[model samples]
Target: MVTDETPMPVLFKKSFKKLPMWDFEDVYNQDAPLRPTTCAESLRNSEDESFRKAFLPNIRLFLHKDNINLTEWNRLSHFNNPFGFMEYKYADVMASVKLIPKPKEPLLLPKPGGDGCVRCAVVGTAGILNGSRMGKEIDAHDYVFRMNGAVLKGHEEHVGNRTSVYVHTSFSITTSLYLFKKYGYTSVPNDEGIKYVMIPEAIRDFNWLEGLLKGEKGAGPYHNKWPRTYYAGQYNESRFYVLHQDFLRYVRNRFLKSAILNSTHWAIVRPTNGAFALFLALHTCDTVSAYGFMTEDYNKYYNYYFEKGVKTKVVFYINHDYMLEKNMWKKLHNSKIIRLYQRTDSGTGTEKPK
Candidate 1:
């Protein structure tokens, strides 16, 4: 299967790996104990049954040169096929990532003063944030997470301009500009030294990573131009990260697994990219606040924060389970695992443009 001669470091992590390796050494327990930092996080431990679960600290969260192997490739095929038929082999992907530095899991470094607090803001693209005036509040967090078609050119006041981690697939990063140009999406956020995290959801993602890390034009329909140009000139390996395959499947299998999976369109059904970004923060940060995500009154606001003119509905496609995500987010918010930003019309159940 491996076709290249590129030297690789020994990947200590494995599928469903339950032992703490390099990045997770400071935060793991074999018994799966609850190390809650805030009063909210203390409410739900691994032993809790009524609520959805967070990724255990022992689980390998990121994929780097030393954290992936052929065995992992086989085990991950069950969740979402990354490269079963593509010409791109694990060897090629590894060769590309070999250039990256070690321990890419925790992008945020250690907390200062040993205060043991890491606060994060997971900002979504839902229209609820059109005029929320939450930019200052979001920026107050230690780190901010954004995903998918994040339109932030003119709406900086609503959704804070900070993008500590931007999680996306190759397709979303490449196509988001043209897809969201109607609302002033000229470029993806390029905050000073912002960390870029890739979710390897499909073959195209692997293809994109292959060409991206090598500083070359990647194969595939969407990748006509050099993949590096999409990042707006912030393509250094030290600031880049790839999420592990098992982490994705773990999220789907445990938290966001929908009834839609039992149907024929199972392959297409998965949690929203925003959901993934939110959970990643939950596992890493000591405290988390979610903004612009789906809520019970989702239909009240426009589909996206950047949309102009009339309000639009949150369109549902077969590929994603929006309702399932909404319920789970509500549960997590209620469970004190994360703080969700919410605003209502005060019993009127009507839309009032801000």
Candidate 2:
């Protein structure tokens, strides 16, 4: 009964109430596997404020016509101004947004099955996974999430070949195709029944979204490019989702609030895309395992799993706080919120990945 009146923390509860499944296939192309309604289904009754308050589901997770109002727009605009900006008017963005299919509450699930939990794996492109042989383990989850420069051709042996959800912004998706071209990267992963989550970081994303949903000619980064052709595979409108601005701001304010946000460069500082992908799974899935994220020993490996150790250095940029991300991932892992993959070896671990 997730309705407009669903209380605060709608996603967290002692147990999830069941929902009718008239057209289950409309949500996912696969058979509905039974999953508990709440992500932490087993600990639904936990009274721990620290854990329960960490994720506030009452705030919209995905953008839909019904969920957003004038007030919500004004609130969200205080940050990156996702709905509108100087580049585009809010009314113009809504024209295309109106065409987007409104997903019902309890989205992207495979249908509840036998009170089982929905397990997910969020895979990053860090070099630590290059030789870890974690492909089999990563693909075993109910859903696999990947983002940014995720080149999985020959290295399928290490990084799993499946991608249930691909999270990206206009910049990441477009730049990845160009940057990873040498590593056999062709297009974004498009598995049957897969979902695409777009993070509208700026006005360009809205322009791209407009082009995508309305078949309009793209402006900005993809000027003159058809949004559909910009992608590599077939996409279904029903399966696509745009992340709500509240969720993005929530993650930054609560978990990974870096020191940079206080400085003049605060506008430029934000969590990595991988961080958003991981958090998305945390709020949506029953169980989450994070792979290829920054760890304490990040310096021991190359910047990206696909890059050669000698050829590229692990460049630390102002856009993201790598050290803060590493510590937060470690903290979350230690807190049992997520299972972060960390490799322990005997050597300095500078060995080239096979």
Candidate 3:
């Protein structure tokens, strides 16, 4: 017997979806004339097999002794031009992503002898977290991760007193470091900050810029800074797996390759900021909860809670497809895989399924 407490299974009708042919082709077969099964059966079987085989365990390639040979070789591929430019920049960009773990560093905070599920709270600077007295609830978790230009001072009474790691881009840090210091926002401790979660896209265009920010010869600008940095690698192989490059490629090849760039109602942000953070949490922690993402009523609040006033929807500048994100979130919510915080008008509390 199904009770009110039990969530009803959600079934998405294909008719309601607006995906194009190519997007469907990558995963679906609209021209399977030789198929002997129903469309649904064919889709399910094909998808099952593809998903299981998609992520290859090993891909070995020859590299030059000088390491410059591959870079020259990559410049020749069709992907090397526009798509090719993404490879290195993606690497540099990911290195700064905070949620990702350094190549082989030990877990920053091992529990009293290393026992217990690692608890992580990913905080976004949304109006939802504004006045809600969730600081205790948020701090109660073992580790906390804040992202972008997060301002934590004024909301302290409501948002609680816990900040383990801060993920930020060079742009965010450079432009706002003085404010963080001015507002009493200390750099998250080096031992605890897990710095460099967000990498700047500009740095990838110049080699000297990369050296300046990350090189260890001496402190350039961000070298040895708080929220220590890291680059992304295989899921189990690296300390953390960031989805920025991976997700950006997926959207480009899978969703936006054919569409006119920046022509749609929404722009798909590269490195999928929130999704990357969530992916890292999913891998790092046994359980995770995401708050302050774009909800159905997201237009009602400002981008950062620190700004007092209604949020005005700026035109989409990045590569994020918020509509697609909304659908994916709904599916995840229905599957009970993660919880999305529901904001109320009063900002006193958050709602989740019991």
Candidate No. with top TM-score: 2
List TM-scores for all candidates, in order.
0.81, 0.82, 0.56
| Candidate 2, pairs of clashing residues | 34-112, 34-113, 35-113, 127-305
RMSD, every candidate, angstroms: 7.0, 10.1, 14.5
Model 1 is weakest, by summed lDDT over 10 consecutive residues, at 24-33
Comparing 1 and 3 on TM-score, the stronger one: 1
Question: What are the per-residue Cα lDDT tens digits for candidate 1 across 47-141?
Answer: 44554335565456677766455554433322333212123345645555565455444666435775667778999988888777788999888
lDDT of 2 at 75: 35
lDDT of candidate 2 over 65-125, digit per residue (tens):
6656554443333344332222334475666556667764455464356345678899998
Candidate models: Cα lDDT each = 0.69, 0.70, 0.42
Pairs with steric clashes in candidate 1:
11-66
Residue by residue across 1-354, what tens digits does model 3's lDDT show? 333433222222222223223332223111112212222321113333433243211111111122222323222111221122323333342233322233332223334543544656777666666566667777787777766555666676556656555554445545555655554555432333343344333432223233333433212344444222322111132322222323233434443343333343212234345555654454345445666666676665655556554444523445556566656555455545456666645442232112
Q: What lDDT, from 0 to 1, does candidate 3 have?
A: 0.42
**What is the RMSD, in Å, between candidate 2 and the native fold over all Cα?**
10.1
Clashes of 1: 1
For candidate 1, give the lDDT of residue 284.
Answer: 75
The C-alpha stretches of model 3 lying farther than 4 A from their native spots are 1-102, 105-116, 178-195, 200-209, 212-271, 309-315, 344-354
